[model samples]
Target chain A: MSGPARTPAEPATAPALEARELEVRFPAGRGRWARAVDGVSLAVRPGQVVALVGESGCGKSTLARALLGLQPVHAGQVLVDGAPLAASRAGLKAYRRRAQLVLQDPMGSLNPRMSVYESVAEGLRIHGVGDEERRVAEALGRVGLRPPERFFARYPHELSGGQRQRVVIAGALVLEPSILVADEPVSSLDASVRGEILALLLRLREELGLSLLVVTHDLGLAWNIADRIAVMYLGRIIEEGSTDEVLGEPKHPYTRALLSVVPEVGRLEPVVLTGEPPDPAAIPAGCRFHPRCPLLRSGLPDEVVTRCHGRALPVLPVQGPHRAACHATDRASADS
Target chain B: MGPGARYALRSVASGLGTLLFVVVFNFFLFRMLPGDPIGLYTRGRNVPPEQIEALRAELDRPLLEQFVTYLANPFASTINSARYNQPVWTLIGDRVWATLLLVGTAIVLASILGTWIGIRAGWRRGERFDRVSTGVTLTLYSMPEFWLGMILLITFGVGVGFVPGVFPIGGIITPGVDPTSLAGVLDVMWHMVLPVTTLMVVYLAEYALVMRASLIDELGEDYLTVARAKGLMDKVVRRRHAVPNALLPTVTLILLNLGFVVSGAITVETVFSWPGLGLLSYDALRGPDIALLQAIFLLFSIGVIVANIIADLLYAVLDPRVRA
Candidate 1:
C-alpha cells in the first residue's frame, strides 16, 4: 500500500526513456496532414511511473507509439539513457529488447492460435536467447500466473479477460526490458480487474526497477499510480508536473475541466465546457483551446483575453517543477 | 469421447446418410426417363424373338425386386453397356485411374502455386506485385473453365506457325508405347500436359483469389501488429503469425474442391478426349444408358461425401477452436 520513494528534483540517474519535441503526422486525404502528435516533449525517469492523460484523439496513443519507435517520427528525437535512439536495424532490435510495449484490449492483442508458452517465449525466440523454458516460466510467475506449466498449453481464448491481460504482460516482461510503455493497459478490462493489473505494474516497477510510461484518460488511475502527470490537449501537453501539484492545483482550464468530472467528496460542480472536441486536422487559430476555454467565457482581463484569441502558445518550459501554457495562468502568476 | 472424435463421428455419419440417399435416388432417376430399358439396351442388335422375350422377362421385373437386387450389390447389379457389352463397373474401373491422375496432379500443383501467390500478394498489399497478381487472378477466375480449356487446346495442342504441336492433341497416351514401361509413363505425362494445364489454370485462379482475400482479412488482425512489435523480422511476422491463421478459410475451400476431383471436369475431358470417367459419362448420356448412368452417379456421390468427411476431420486438426 505504501508509495515508492519520491523522485528527487535532480535525480542522479538519467531518464530511462525520453521524447524531445516529438511530432507525428498522417496524411489527411487530399494533400493536408493531420498532426497527430505535434511538438511534445516528456521524460520517464528510471523506476518512475509517468502517466500521459488526455481525452480520446488527443494523440496520447500516437505519442506512445512514437516513443517505442513503432511509428516513424516526423521531427524531434527519442533518447535512451541520455543518448538518441540508434538508427540501424541491429540497434533498433537491441533497443526493442531493452524496451517493450503492452497494448490495450488484451483480448485482441494476444494471438488466439498461440499457446501461453509460445506467446511468452516469442521475444526470446526472436532475439535468439537461450534457456527459454526457464525464462518463460519465470515471466509467467512474475505476472502471478502460478505454476506456469499449467498455463503453458492454454490459449488466449481459454483464459479470462484479466488472465489474458496478464499473459500479455508476461509476454512483454519475458524479455526483461528496462522500461515498459503500456498504452491504456487496463482500459478494456472489467472495472473489478483494473486495480489488480495496475498494482501488478507498480509491483513490477518496485521489484525490477522498471520504468513505466502509462497512457490513459482516467485521472483516478494517474492519481493512484503515476509519480508525475502530463495532461495533453490537441496533440500538445498543456500542463505537466508532479501528480500532487497538477491535480491539487490545476492551472489550465482544460485540465481543470477534466479534473472537475472526477467524482469526489464535497468538490465543486463539474465544469461542462460547450464545444466540439478539437480536430487535429484543423486546429483553431491562436491558442488551440481558446474556442473551448471556459475562462475566456468567464471574463479574463482585456489584454490577456486578446492574447488568448490572437497568439499561439509555446511548448512547456523545461526549467519549472510545474508548468502550464495559458495566458490567464501567466497573468495570475504575474499578479501574485 | 473427445470433442474431435465426436465431431468426426457426426460428420462421417451424415456423409454416409447422404451417400445412401444418393444410392436410392440414382436407381429411380434413370427409370423415370420415359424410355424402355430393353429398347435402349438392345438398340441395333439382331436377336431372336424368344431371346428378346427372355431379356424382357429378366429386366422387366417388379420395381421392388429390382430395388432389392440393386440394394444387394449396387455396382455389380448394373446391366452390361450397349456399346461395349461390358459390365458398367469394369468400364468405370478402367477410367478411374486416368481421371485421378489428371485431377489429382492439377489440384496439388494449383494449391501450392496459388497459396504462395496469395501469401506474397496479400502481405505486400497495394504494391505493384499485389495489384498485378490480384487483377490477373481475378480475371482468370471469372473466365469460363471450358473456354480457357479450349484456348489451351488450340494454342498448345495443335501446331501454329513456327511452333510445332508440343504436346499430343488428345488421348491419355500414344498407341505404340509399352503400357508398363517408363517410356509409357513419360508419354502419359506428356499427353497430360495440356489437359492438366487447363484444369490448373481454372483451379489456380480460385485458390489464389480466395487465399488473397482471406490473408487480407488476417492482415488487419491485432496479432500481426503484436508480432511485428516483438522485434521479429517482417517476413517472420507474415509467415509465422499471419499466414497460419489466414490459411484456415482457404484450407476449407481447397478440401471442398478436392471433393469434386472424382466427378472430373466433363467439358474439359470431352474437349481433350481424355479416356476418363468424364468422357465415359459424356458417352453414356448419348445412349441414355440407364444402368451405367446410375452406377456413375453413385460413384460421384460417394467421392464427394467421403471428401466432406475428410474435410471436417482435417479442419478440426488445423484449427484448435474447431476441436472444442
Candidate 2:
C-alpha cells in the first residue's frame, strides 16, 4: 500500500499537541511571581514520542501541563491539531478528551480506596462516554492487563508498583486521548518495572498511533524510547532535535553537562557542572543557564565570554533537525 | 483462620479485657468515695436499727465476693440505687434510651453536616464560604456546652417581654404528661431542642474540622490531580476520588463519637435538667451513690469498647490495606 492518505476532516500534518511561547507563573510571595515555564514552544506530531528532559525544577512538567491545558498559561497558547485551544467549557472538555495526563507516583496516583475498574472507568464516566464496560476492559487489555476482570475488584495497594502504573495508564487510555502527557511516569517504579512501562508506552504509540510527550529527568529514559528530545533548563528549551542527533552531538552547553553525567559503560572524562540551577524567581541575566555553564568557565575568548555573560541567546539552527540556544556554540561554529 | 480474621478476633478479645478492667475499677472506686448511701437514703433522720442493719448487710459485703457475684450474673439487678429505693440497672434502663436518642440524633446530624461542609471547604479551600464556615464552626466548637445550652435556654426560653420564648427552659417533657401521645411526644422533642442543639453545635465542629483537615490532606494527593486530569468536574473529583480516602480517618473519629453517646453530655444535660445518664450520674455523685455510679460507668465503658470494635471492623472493610 502507498503511504496512508490524509482524512479530509483532520489535516494529517497537524501536530497532535503544540505549545507556542508558553509561560506559567506561580505567586512566590510579596507581590513577586516565579516563572515556572518561561517563553517556550514545542510540538508533538501525530504518532510520535517526544521526551522532555530537564532537572528537577526545570519546568518540563509545567510545559506538559500547559500542553494538556491543565495549567493556566500566563502567556501564549496551546494548540490542538493546529487549532488554538478553546477557552469555553464545552470546548475545553472536548480538548481534554484529546489529551490526558499520567502522573509520577503510581502508588499515589491511583485512589487506594477505588478498585481498578472504578479508576479506569472514571475518565469514561466523566466525559459521558458510552459502552463503559467494554471500553474500560479494552483499555486495560491494551495496557497488557489480560482478562481485566481479575483486577476489576482489586484496590491499588493490592497491586504491585508495575501493575498499579498499568492501571494508571489504563485510566488514561480509557479516554482514547490522542496525546498522552506522562510526567516522570516510571520514576517511582522499580528499575525492572521501568523498562516494562517504557516499552508499554512505545508499544501503545505504535499500535494506536498515539502521540506521547514524556517529561522526565532521566537522560537514559530519553535515549531508551524517545523519537525526539527537548532539553529544558530553567524553564527554557536549550536544545531540540532527534534523539540520536541531540544525544550523540549535544550543541547546547546545558545539554552537554546533563549528558556528561549519564553514567556510560566506558567513557572516562565526565563533565561535572558546578553549582545548582539558579532560583527561577531570581534567574541569572543573559542565558538562564549561564550560571552553571562549564563552557563559560573554560577560558573562552574575551568577546565570546562577554556575549555569554551579557546577551540573550536565540535558538540557532545547527545541522539537520538540531538547534541549540548558546553563544559559545555560535562562536565555535564561526571559528570552525 | 486467616491473618485478618485472627487480627479481628484479637482486637475483640482485647476490647473485652479492657471492659472487664473498667467494670472492676468503677465498682471499687465508687465504694471508696466518702459518704454513706444509707444515711443519704434516710435523710439523716432517725431510722430503725433493723433497717439500718439490713442496708449495711446489702452493701458492706467483701469487695472480692461482690465482684465475683457480679461476674457470675452481671445482668441481674443485684445493685440498688441509694436514693430511689429501686435497682440501679432498672433506673438506668429508664434513662438510657432517652440519653441515646438525644446524643444519637446530635451525632447523626453533626456527621452529615460536618462531612458535607468539610468536603466543600476542602475542595474549594480559601473560598469565602470555606473561611466563614470554618470560623463559625470553630467558634461554636470552642464554646462550653453548658454555657451554650444556658444561652439557648435563656434566649429561647426566657425571651424579652415583647418577644416571647419559643422553647422550654429545661426538662425532657412537661411534668405528668402522657409520653406516648402525640402532644407529649411533641413536648419532649420541643424540650430536646435546646440541649440537642448545644451538643450538636459543639460536636459539629469536631467532625467538620477533622473532615476538613483530612480532606485537605487527601486533596493534595497525586490521585486527585489524576482525577482532575481525567476531565472530571471539580465536584466529581472531590466526591469520587477525594472523599472516600479522606473519609477513612474520619470514620474512626465518628465511631468514637458514637461510643460517647451512651454517657450523654453531662454539662448540657445538667443545664437542661434532662433525665438522661449524664444527669443521673451527676445526681448520684452528690449522693455518692456507688451502685448507680458504678452501673453508669459500666454502661459508658461498654459503649466505648463496642464502638471501637465496630470502628476497627469497618476500617478493615473500607480500607483493604488495613486487612493485613
Q: Judged by DockQ, which candidate is best? A: 2
Query: TM-scores of all models?
Result: 0.91, 0.91
What would the per-residue lDDT of candidate 2 be over residues A179-287, giving only the tens digit for each residue?
9999999999999999899989988987888989999999878887887788888888888888877788888888887887787412435788887656778777777
**Residue A29: error of model 1 in Å?**
2.7
Candidate 1 lDDT for residue B241: 85
Q: Residues B24-110, candidate 1, lDDT per residue (tens digit)?
A: 888788767897888888889875788779878877899889888887788774468876688888999999999999999999999
Model 1 backbone overlap count = 0
Model 2 local distance difference test score: 0.83
The residue-by-residue lDDT of candidate 2 on B60-158, one tens digit each, is: 888789878877766576647776868988899899988998999999998898888887887789999899989998899889889988888888888
Q: Please tell me the TM-score of chain A for candidate 2.
A: 0.92
Candidate 1 chain A, run of 10 with poorest lDDT: A1-10
lDDT (10s digit) by residue, model 1, range A244-324: 888888888898999989874126468998987788988877678999999999898898878888788787743248878
For model 2, the superposed segments whose C-alpha errors exceed 4 Å read A1-12, A265-268, A315-320, A331-336, B1-14, B31-46, B58-63, B160-165
On a 0 to 1 DockQ scale, where is model 2?
Answer: 0.69
